[model samples]
Target: MTEYLLYYWPGIPGRGEYVRLVLAEGGADWIDVEREGAPDGEPALSDILSDTSRHHLPFAPPFLKHGEVVLAQTALICDYLGGRLSLAPEGKKDRRFALQLALTIADLVAEAHDIHHPVAAALYYEDQKQAAARAAETFRDTRIPKFLGYFEQVLKANPDSQDWLVGETRSHADLALAHTVDGLTYALPNAMEAALEDHRRVRDLSRRVRALPAIAEYLDSDRRQAFSEHGIFRHYPELDA
Candidate 1:
């Protein structure tokens, strides 16, 4: 069995957490490259990403290397790992459904990040504080509810009805949603508290994912990274409702 190598930024969970959950649950033999401090730090991550030799180059971090294949993008990496690790939904239809769900979850994650960096990714939150506040208000009022409501309805509409987001079994999408929920709660506690109440199914799904055996252990382990200012989801009291 070829051990998987995950290339993600050090410290914060970010998009890598989504892929980490799958690897943890599946008991995959994987190594978190930069986190372990082997070759170097962010430089190694950047070099691998900019490597011109590879025809299929990934645009960013959170990419997974399996043998010669380098898969990037949180959604794509999660989907690829899910299937290989037996964490994916069975059959052609469910597989596509899970992928779509993961993609949708990614959209929500991006929006959550934009709340703090509404103007530009390069500018610090301090420079864009005023803009972030305005953007966050709309995000809390409209986007949060819309995305959470969609996930809630999706769970209710799932034919499996076994608490998983996609099919009966837990898939990459479910894991990703759980991670997103944790981030949202950390970043916008006030908004998430009210939204979670209205979205019980989604809440339960996130809880269920957290309660999984491997995940429970992983959460308590040193490997599990906490939510902070650097990650996609960030807490700025002024931005929250």
Candidate 2:
């Protein structure tokens, strides 16, 4: 059996959730290293960066150590795993479309992160609460609609003969869309509800993806992490209208 070692902060969903969704959907065997807050959590992220002894240092958490290969970047990791899991399309255009979908997900993920820390990633959410409040409004009122609209178009235009983002069967991109929708709903329920009213395909896609056996099982299991204050998508009632 093949094994994958995924190193990520066990607590926060962050970017790690993207990789996790793919692994769960593929039913891939993997370890979630640092599986929650530790009393001495591997000497803080900065300390780990200072140390060079660690083999194959990843630029960040959510890096996958697949035997000798070390892969980073959420989308790249998904693309690599997609090929390994035969989730990628065999056709040239279909494969390209899959990559495009992944890129779009990345864009949305960044935007979501910005919602809580709009002014700067360096500043803590507490420090920038005022800015984040304003930013979240813009995101809810303008940004989420625009980004999800793009995804809506992709699914509607879906060059292939399927309901998924690419190819006929579900791909990493489809899983990604589901995860994004789930995260947004958890973080900004009001905004998510408003956004869904316009994008029927994305809303339907999210529901269908959640109904998948493995995903349904994962959601029910203790292994699935819940959204919290420290995560990328945070529940700020003030931000929601």
- Indicate which candidate wins on lDDT: 1
Model 1, 87-181: lDDT tens per residue?
88988999998999999999999999998999999999999999999999999999999999888888888888659888888999999999999
Q: Would you give me the overall lDDT of model 2?
A: 0.81
Give the Cα error of residue 201 in candidate 2, in Å: 0.1
Residue 143's lDDT in candidate 2: 88
The ten-residue window of minimal lDDT in model 2 covers 36-45
**C-alpha lDDT of all candidate models, in order:** 0.89, 0.81
Clashing pairs in 1: none
Q: Candidate 2 — which pairs collide?
A: none
Candidate 1 has an lDDT of 0.89
Error of 1 at 111 (Å): 0.5
Q: Once all C-alphas are superposed, what RMSD does model 1 give against the true structure?
A: 2.2
Error of 1 at 60 (Å): 0.9
TM-score of each: 0.95, 0.89
Residues 33-150 of candidate 2: C-alpha lDDT, one tens digit per residue: 6673323223443444455887756788778767767778888898888888876777887877788888888898888888888888888889999988888889888989998899
